[model samples]
Target: MMMTMATAAAVAVEDSTTDDVQPLSTLKMQAAQVAMDSGAVIHASPDVLGKNGEDSAWVTVNVTAPSPSAGHWVALFSPADFGYGLPSYLLVYMFANVSPSFMSSGSGNLRFLVINQRSDYAFGLFSGGKDNPKLIAISNKVSFANSKAPVFPRLSQGKEWNEMAVTWTSGYNINEAYPFVEWKMKGGESSKRTPAGTLTYTRRHLYSYQIGHELPDGTVVWGKSSTFRASPFPGQDSLQRVVVFGDMGIGQRDGSNELAGFQPGAQVTTDRLIKDLPNYDAVFHIGDLSYSNGFLAQWDQFTAQIEPIASKVPYMVASNVVVLCRCSGNHERTYQDTGGFYNGNDSRGECGVPAETYFYVPAENRGKFWYAADHGMFRFCVGDRCFSSVDRKHQPWLVFAAHRPLGYSSNDYYATEGSFSEPMGRTLQGLWQKHRVDLAIYGHVHNYERTCPVYENTCMDGKSKQDKGSYSGAMGGTIHVVAGTGGAKLRDYSAGPSPQWSVVRDKSFGYVKLTATDHSSLRVEFIHSDDGAAHDAFDITRDYKDVLACTVDSCAPHTMAN
Candidate 1:
């Protein structure tokens, strides 16, 4: 898939526990005291799964204890040897109360969805609730047909417009197997192989490819085949669609992990994206992806959840086009005294390791977390560490994309701070105005919000008599959009009156789709995930001259000598 471009600066507010805490953190595993009940039993079946090469499977778990209570719970652990592993990744956990009759009957059957994360799994029954979990019984080991089979093949635009990069995860190392992508032009007779680390030129043609690992014996273990249309040439006039959203943590299809009320909209948004896969070309998950926080196992779950859309299209967690501009979000990079701008322990101790290691973006230094990418007529200066400098003559749409809203928002959290945005949110105001950025999109607020062309807290268009739905001619100021509505619990707008520049706010599960009909017209729509309908939209209509025209403080210095 074609990861695109964006740019911005990092300025964050400390997130509240209600919004950013990882679910697993509620469990005090370190203090867990084993209270074995010989008569109590926990069993999971069928003992095997994924016989058809499926990546995920649903299993039924039956548990019985001497005295079932609200405190009793069940957890799925990976590596099958959770006893000795000081910190085992818990794949999923749920209270026995969810079974409805467990409290009275002392036994109940629950269902769980498990994925091929290249590991073995087991279910454990525990008592004493989350604060003081007690292991009672363990289920027999459950395994997939091929636990180490290559899975979750993600695509990113390569360093060049014509190049594409495919990355995946597997159990085999170089000595055991060689990883490569087998590709062919759509319907072509012959196919070619590109080894891992080598770029494959797909250009603009429709191509089909599959990830595989060649074993020492020369036998090939292949993943499912998928197709993607290559990115159009930069500056090309063609219809382009890109999806942007943030804070979408992993969704529990089996209904586990609901106690925390985290990310209720995640699965629906994911389903909407999958259903509308044919309509858009690429996706940008701006930040707070997976909400994994610190439990590393959730990363696998997040990847499994997004594989359907990502494996087939260009799903960018970082890159917008060619540049990987990033300042890791609190959940991805922050830890106490970790040198991050924020002093929160939101990352639990992850400190950006999993995020930097898991995803591939074309960053000069992956640790810095920022880069640039181009898609047709759109120029994305996507990073949070600094401002992006771009020539707007060819790609008129200069966008600043980040995980946090550095532009404008009216969420209650920021509203109370009296800034209506993150602390130091507008520190980059001068840079944005100087670059004439058309739109700045962000994802930390957990709600939908849009601003009219605004600068310095003033609505540039409100005074110009410009229509709200359609903007034409020179964009006097950048339009800021907060689309953190990609799952996670939705937040409410400020109880106070809406700011004049805050044109719209919707507490719904949805994403923003930017459709560039051509070089001169861009349409942005906030599509609700529940019904796959656009609840709000606006269009920007302008000519190349309008882009070059002076806007507030963005005009070049005048020279009479010329």
Candidate 2:
């Protein structure tokens, strides 16, 4: 997730070594030198794709180069007319050396998993390396059967607990075709239709739906059908499970883009979530989703990667930038003279515009990039750049989440800074303590670590290993959990001795699951994505009275005379 577009002719560089080397960033695209070769021919088969209502399809590319070298490579570009102008998107690239016999045979065949990105595509052969790519061959145009078809339905909870919001991507506008969702209760006799931008829900019933664009001629361009269960009523006492993680970048199934590097465990974790989809009711990908940086097409690849899970559950998201006052990754927000706190060019020319445009959340103002959501007994104050007050009586579990480690983390870089968190992260300490926040979760360190119930650098509870895994009564402080193990290369903990407040640390690719059995108890587990097993876990047993009890600065003042 730590990657971004270059601001100029050179690639953007960051202080951290963990920045993902975006495959698309390797090319000197702006100043590319053209040397079209007649002997070198490039072609892609099954040019017309998505013929079976599929949003994505596999295409085979054949390359014949009279003179090939190790530096030779290929690129996928959209809006096919790459020679006239820069392609709208440089979708993906791979080295010609991938084929074992490519150098000797002067020909190679490669498989690519291409999604319908609302544009036609062309494959280009390059003679020189990424730094001085010389386009030698251009393939014929390839496109989906209906490039404007509505697709990639992403689910999110509406402002109301019983309401579900569905957002999707389509090439059509309201004037071209009316967008709507046709749905029905799983067992209902008749189905009903709701306009695309409207809410659709009824209690916790499972509903099946199809998103489509209704043409003026009464025809329809339908996307894949999917099903989802509505959120339970607010504070409803039931077994509620939630999946939380961060920093998951895109993975290539065909292995075309991995040569330059990508999130190695992204597909594994994505498949795990899909396999375990029946268990969790919702997901909170706190930040760094897609890691598109400024490569716009990668966003489509990321959405298609998570479609199986997002299309089913409420796939909540947050920004990856500074948690307190920022709402997206430095790669999404930081640009020279943009007024972002971080003074850099990590986002190339994009200043949070693409991310804000691509995703939908329950935030009051999408520009603010913060929101409050309720799932049964849990109340989540997600990505609030400012302190947002909440009523904790009904939803007894008050949790706060943001992208960076705003509370605590012994990440080596943060350790060097002596803050144990992103600079200014602890600004929320007063708010969390005053509001009695139970848990504060974060991602961005690219590892898993859980602190003891702690405040102000002190472990408020569980000082002994024997007492570490469980808690009860009026827990005095918030438990900070970092679950940034969603596939980007795992980072190392500080080389120094483990901090006392640090209860557990694991450098595994996994996610955190919080299961609320009832208002009286909560079970938290760190489940490894590989085996789907809980490697670290803890429990909190308390009651409504416990939540009301004073802890540190949590309670209001009272007069003893009373």
TM-score of each: 0.92, 0.93
User: What's the CA error at residue 387 for candidate 2, in Å?
Assistant: 8.1
- The worst-scoring run of ten residues by lDDT in candidate 1 lies at 1-10
User: lDDT of each structure?
Assistant: 0.78, 0.79
Give the winner by lDDT. Answer: 2
Error in Å for residue 229 of model 2: 0.5
Task: Report the C-alpha lDDT of model 2 over 397-425, residue by residue, as the tens digit.
Answer: 88888777888999876787664586556
Candidate 2 regions with alpha-carbon error over 4 angstroms? 1-19, 83-88, 320-326, 383-391, 558-562
Assess the local accuracy of residue 230 in candidate 1 as a C-alpha lDDT between 0 and 100: 86
Models, CA RMSD each: 3.9, 4.2
Kindly provide the TM-score of model 2 when superposed on the true structure, using C-alpha atoms.
Answer: 0.93
